[model samples]
Target chain A: QQPVQSPQAVILREGEDAVINCSSSKALYSVHWYRQKHGEAPVFLMILLKGGEQKGHDKISASFNEKKQQSSLYLTASQLSYSGTYFCGTEIRAAGNKLTFGGGTRVLVKP
Target chain B: SAVISQKPSRDICQRGTSLTIQCQVDSQVTMMFWYRQQPGQSLTLIATANQGSEATYESGFVIDKFPISRPNLTFSTLTVSNMSPEDSSIYLCSVGTGPTTGELFFGEGSRLTVL
Candidate 1:
């Protein structure tokens, strides 16, 4: 099943913060985050395994709650380069390596 | 980490024609995957290209419509056959180390616009 992403769209001023959430109805083995600008392919960001680990890159970080079957991506002190569509791809343990991506959340950052 | 590239970044084609998109990886990979992203939509897996054998397509996709060729570990091609406006999408090829993390690296993608 496809994952659900919250806050369809968001706009923030530079140096602000925002959070995008992804939830799945089924248990997820891992959750992967990716960002894509207009006219480009999605870029890999980070992955959260089943152990409920939190991963960070630069000012971007994410937390996965195994029991809740959800994950949250935190963008702190957002920069202009942070503007893009963010997608959460879920991997189920029984489904091999295939990923089912969420609808995505469009984020815009104003200077 | 793998460096991937796709040909024909964007193309406009007539209906009923076919377009073949090529994907090349800098290093050999055990698996390569093809995905379709329709306008304003999330990525959808089309198939898993296995070298030296038939491709494993997803539920809604078939080999006749989206033929895939994985001649080697580092290269593959996805051909959109009998194209129509509905077939227009961004086709991406991805490769990963393995199924453990489910982490994949994607190409720039080949954009197709059928009219």
Candidate 2:
């Protein structure tokens, strides 16, 4: 099943912080984060496999709460490059490597 | 990580026609997946293409409409048949290194506009 993402869109000045949340109705085994720039393919950001696991990339970090079937991506001190559409992909129990992606949240960071 | 390349990076086709998009991986992979993303929408799995077997498609997708072929471990193709305007979307080719790998390497998607 597809995940539900909060704040379908966001606008922020450079150096501001933002949080995007993703929740799924079904049980999840892993949650993956990806970012897609305009006219580009979705790029893998990180994957959280265990419950309460947190991973970071530059100023971007994500936390997975397997118990709640939810994951949150944190973007701190956002830069212009951080402007893109973020998608959370979920791999649920018995789903193997197949991922169901969320609707996506568009982030726009301006100077 | 694997490098994937897709052919016909973008195309405009007339209704009632068919278009085949090709994907080539730099190295061998176990599973190849095809995903479709409508404009301003999330990625939806079209099917899983595995070597030496028929493709497994997701619900609302059928081989007759989105035929997939995996002749080898590094290459696969997805063809959209009898296209309609609603079929316009970006089709991406992806693959993981192994069975349990959570990260997928994706090719520059093929953007199709059916009119």
Candidate 3:
């Protein structure tokens, strides 16, 4: 099943902060975050395992809640380079080697 | 991490023609996957390419329409058969390091414009 992403789009100014949430109805073994610029392929950001852990990249961090079957990505002190569409891909418990991606959240950071 | 390369970054083809997109990985991988993303839409899995065997197509996708070939661990190709306007989309190839975490690395993508 496809994950659900909240706040389809968000605009932030430089040095601002924002959060993108992804929720799945089914139990998730792992949640992966990716970013894609307009007309470009998606780039891998981080992956959260089933253990309900958090991963960080620079000012970007993501946390997965195993009990809630949800994940949240936090962008702190956002920069202009953070402008892109973010997608959360979920790996269901019984779905091996298959990932269902969320609709996506478009983030625009302006200076 | 794997370095993935795709050919024909963008192409314009006629309706009746077929186009084959190629994916190459720097390191050997166990499985490679194909995905399609329509304009302003989320990525959808097309199939899983297995080395020396037939590829598995996802729901709403068929092997006859999108034939795949995984000749080896480092290379795979997805051919769009009998293209149409609806087939105009960005096709991406990805490879997971293993089956455990479902973490994957993706290629830049090949954009096809069917006329």
Best candidate, lDDT-wise? 2
Which sections of candidate 1 miss by over 4 Å? A94-96
DockQ of prediction 2: 0.72
Q: Give TM-score values for chain A, per-prediction.
A: 0.96, 0.96, 0.95
**In model 2, which runs have C-alpha deviations exceeding 4 angstroms?**
none
TM-score for each model: 0.96, 0.98, 0.95
What does candidate 1's lDDT look like per residue over B10-106, in tens digits?
9999999999999999999876899999988899999999999999998999999999999999999999999999998999998986755656889
Ranking by DockQ: 2, 1, 3
lDDT by residue (A1-111, candidate 3, tens digit) is 799998899999999999999999988888999999998778889988855699999999999999998999999999999999999998886455578899999999999
Q: Please list all clashing residue pairs in model 2, or write none if there are none.
A: none
Best by the TM-score measure: 2
- What is the per-residue lDDT of model 1 for residues A12-104, given as tens digits with 9 covering 90 to 100? 999999999999999888899999999887889998985579999999999999999999999999999999999999987745557889999
CAPRI class of candidate 1? medium
- Comparing 1 and 2 on TM-score, the stronger one: 2
Candidate 3 TM-score, true structure as reference = 0.95
Q: Candidate 3, residues B1-115: lDDT per residue as tens digits?
A: 8999999899999998999999999999977999999989999999999899999988999999999999999999999999999999999999987756656888999999999
lDDT of 3 at B23: 99
